[model samples]
Every structure is written in C-alpha cells, then in structure tokens.
Target: MTETITGLHDVADRFDAFLIDQFGVLRDGAGPYPQAPAELKKLRALGKKIIILSNSGKRSVENSVRLAKLGFDEACWDWFLTSGETAWRMMAAETDGGARKRCLLISRDGDTSPLDGLDYNRTEDADTADIVLIAASEGDRYDLGHYQTLLQPAAERGLRCLCTNPDKVMLTADGKAFGAGRIADLYEELGGAVTWIGKPFPDIYDQAKIFLGAIPPRRICAIGDSVEHDIAGARMAGIASILVETGIHAEASPTERAALFALHEAAPDFILPDFRL
Candidate 1:
C-alpha cells in the first residue's frame, strides 16, 4: 500500500518484470491470500512482465492449473515456470547425449507424468542413475530409512543431487507439507552434497527473466518469506525484495529476526506484516 522504492531502482528496474515466489509471498499453502490476487492484478494493469517461478517440479502447466485453482489468473502475469520443469531440463541436459540413463526419483503419486522418457528406478538402483533428483513427491510412505539405505548410495558415489524445491516446509491449505529441501537436508546430513538448480539460485532467475523474452532482471520485483533464500537471492540478484511475515518463521523470536537480517547483511526493502498480498 506504500510506494517506498529501493535506491537501487535504477539498476533494479531493467526488466520491468517480476519473478514472484509462491508459498509465502502470494499465498500460504492453504488458499490464495486475500490481497495477493488483487496485488497481482494491479501489477498487470500497470503492464508489468511477470513470471511465477515455483519450485514445484511438475512444470508450468501444473502451476497453471494449481494457480487458477488457488485463484491466480494467468492474465495477471506473462509467464509461469517451475523448479520441477527446470529440474527436468537440467537432468535431460546432463544425461548422455546418446545413451539412455536411469533415474531414481522420489516423486508424488500423480506427479510422475513430467518424467516420461527417463528410465525410472527405485532407491536400490541409486548406483545406476546418472543423476539423483528430488522433488515434492508423495510423502505418505517416505521415511528416513529410504534415504539411509537407498538414496544415500547415489549421493555417496558423488552422483549429482538435484533439488527441485529448496524449501524445507510449507503450510498449504491441507497443512504443512515437506518439499525437496527436506530431502536435500537428509542427504546432506548423510554427508551428501547437492546443487539446487532453481530459485534462491541465480541460474533459475536468469533463465526465467530471460524467458520473459526481453525483460531485464532489474525490472523484476522479487517477493517471498525465506530470508536465507528469497531475500538473500534477491539481494544477490540485485532485485527488490518484499518480505511476507505470514508463513514459515512468522513467529520468529527477536534473536531469529536478528539472525535473518544478519544472514544477508542487506535488509528487505518492503516487509508485509501479513501475507495479505
């Protein structure tokens, strides 16, 4: 509701574009925020080039369906890209140009549709995979054992651990949900390393902004909750960041807030007291 612009607006205004985060900024996983739809709609009327860069691995089509179901109209922005889609592309690119490779994935039940051609394998087949990829898959049966016995091998052998979503958890309409960040954490705890190919990372931001087709990164306004990822990522990318204090660490203690602010050395330009938009 306030027009407080950042001093770096000159350099950050290049794209006139926006690459918004999903969970904390726009809505809490439960349903669309009361003011998010309107905020986006107003931005659209202002002719902002926008892209929904979600960490969900199923790609933008899935986001298209989910966003609408969550009350976000496609007309509000120009593009929508997901970490799932980005993860798939990264895997496909790393695979042998000719030889087919197997993949051991922990995906949701109905979410395996995007991973069509790649060979599917179980956790036991960890050694066979050219890459170890993790997404926000079905977690009903997912336990620490699977990682300890199966996926650990893939990571131990130095196979690339790719995380589609780098978020540890999110409170959706149903309840709190675990994403690839948790899985990645498990692997890391087991002495495995990974490369998150999407947001909070620069590569995804560059790709999505470029995909906005002529839009510059400075023109984009980044919004989200995770100071470690969203806010820090925006600072590194030199874009304006808006912090929504309505999810994740919303009830942060004073020490927590200090650590969050100190994590980046730079503070957010805008802070939404609640996830209203």
Candidate 2:
C-alpha cells in the first residue's frame, strides 16, 4: 500500500538526504515551479543533504545556469548531477584513441554542447557514424514519426544509440511532449542497439552512490513526478521514493496510479501532490 501525503514535510525527518528530479519536480519547460526553490531551501535549512539528480542530458554547469536564471539559489542543494554530464564524461573517456569519433546526434534546435569538449565528430548522415546520441527534441512541434527516416537506416546498420534523456514524455507548462526516450524506443524497434541513460537505469544510480558516500540507501529519499522514471529508478537503486502528482501523472486517477505501480512492479514509499516542503 502506498501512503499519500501533502508534501515533503510530512516525512522530512525520516531521511538524511534527498535525491530530487529536476524536470517536473523542480520546473517545467518554461520556468521553475513557483514554490520549488523555497521548499528546497527549507529542506536545506533543516541540514538535510540534497542532490539534484536530473535525467536531463544537459551538462551540469548548463543546468546550474538554467536553474539560477529561473530564480533557484545554489545554496539549496549540496551538489548537482545530470545524465548529460555523465554521458559527456563517459564519451570523453572512450579509449578509441582516434583522431575523432563520428556520431549522429539528435538534439534540440541543433544544440551540440553536450558533445562539446569530446573527441567526437558530429555528422548529419547516420550511416557513416559510429554511434547515435540523443540529447533533446522539439517534441511539442514534432512527432516520433518525423524521425523515422533518419533512425530507420541507422537501425538497419545496427548502430548503437546512447540516449541521455530516458523519459518518454516530459511535462511542460504548456502540456506533455515527447522526449529523447521516445526516439530511443523508435530506434530499438527499428533494430538498433540502444543504451538508455539516466533514470530507471542502474548506471546513473551507481554514479550517484559515488557522491552519497556512506549513507545507506534507506536513509536517502528520491523525489520526482514521474513514476516510470523516478519511482522505478529509485527502486532499482534500492532507495525509497516519493512520487509527486504534479508532473506527467498529474491527471492520473487513483486507479490509474495503482495500475502504474502494479505495472512497473515498483511503488514509491509515499506520494505527494507536489514537492512543497
């Protein structure tokens, strides 16, 4: 049975640290959630260690800048980790040792900063590329079908895809839109090998453990709005989770929520309307 609560304050005393998701939990596409920064400050004031563990494939410093511009102060959390930064580090450490690695990148507005500082060469032609990297998308304006022509050929060549954002859909202020995970799914269906990074994957959790040090998993709580990503990811990492009802699942009925947890075979320890600390 899952316990439904109003906010993080209800169970704040139970955990020594918090691993929070950034998208729906902290902000939408347009801007930060009105109460998010202050609520995080409250948690910080209580001396709880906080880490912003976002599935976003954007670099950590870029995320920090974005958050700062959105009115969030850096004092709210101890550290920040993003799947994009993780991907960049892994790719940069690749031992291929070639002049430059070629990759086909799927990104938003042609932003290629995630691949910056790496030895990878970006290519518009997928057939000649060594791998595929999905960082972002214009989901609100484009559908999955729009990417089929590009992915189909790569899939047939058995190209391996590295998806930074593993969220199928993201909740924005305007509405829901497809994410990089959706592109990864399409590539898989087309016969390409895919490495979905970020939430719901064990690799990110392993990386997070490096930052959390001696704190046992039970003493840490992961708060997010997506059950498929946040809740399931926390479960995989052996940590407690709190699913906020404000993101993609905002409109889900009680029965629907039950079905989702049952479907994923992973339920959050608690549920909240939002992260109002």
Model 1 agreement with the true structure over 134-156: per-residue lDDT tens digits: 77644445665765677777767
Q: RMSDs, each prediction?
A: 4.1, 1.2
The regions of model 2 sitting more than 4 angstroms off are none
Report the number of clashing residue pairs per model.
17, 1
- Candidate 2 structure quality by residue, lDDT tens digits, 1-277: 6898887888999999899999888888788889988988888999998889988878888888888889999878877888898889888878477678788999887888888888888998977988899988778878778888878888999888999999999765578888889888889888888888899998788888878899888899999988889999999999999998877888899899989999988899999888888
Question: Model 1: what TM-score?
Answer: 0.83
Per-candidate TM vs. native? 0.83, 0.96
Give me the displacement of residue 48 in model 2, in angstroms.
1.2
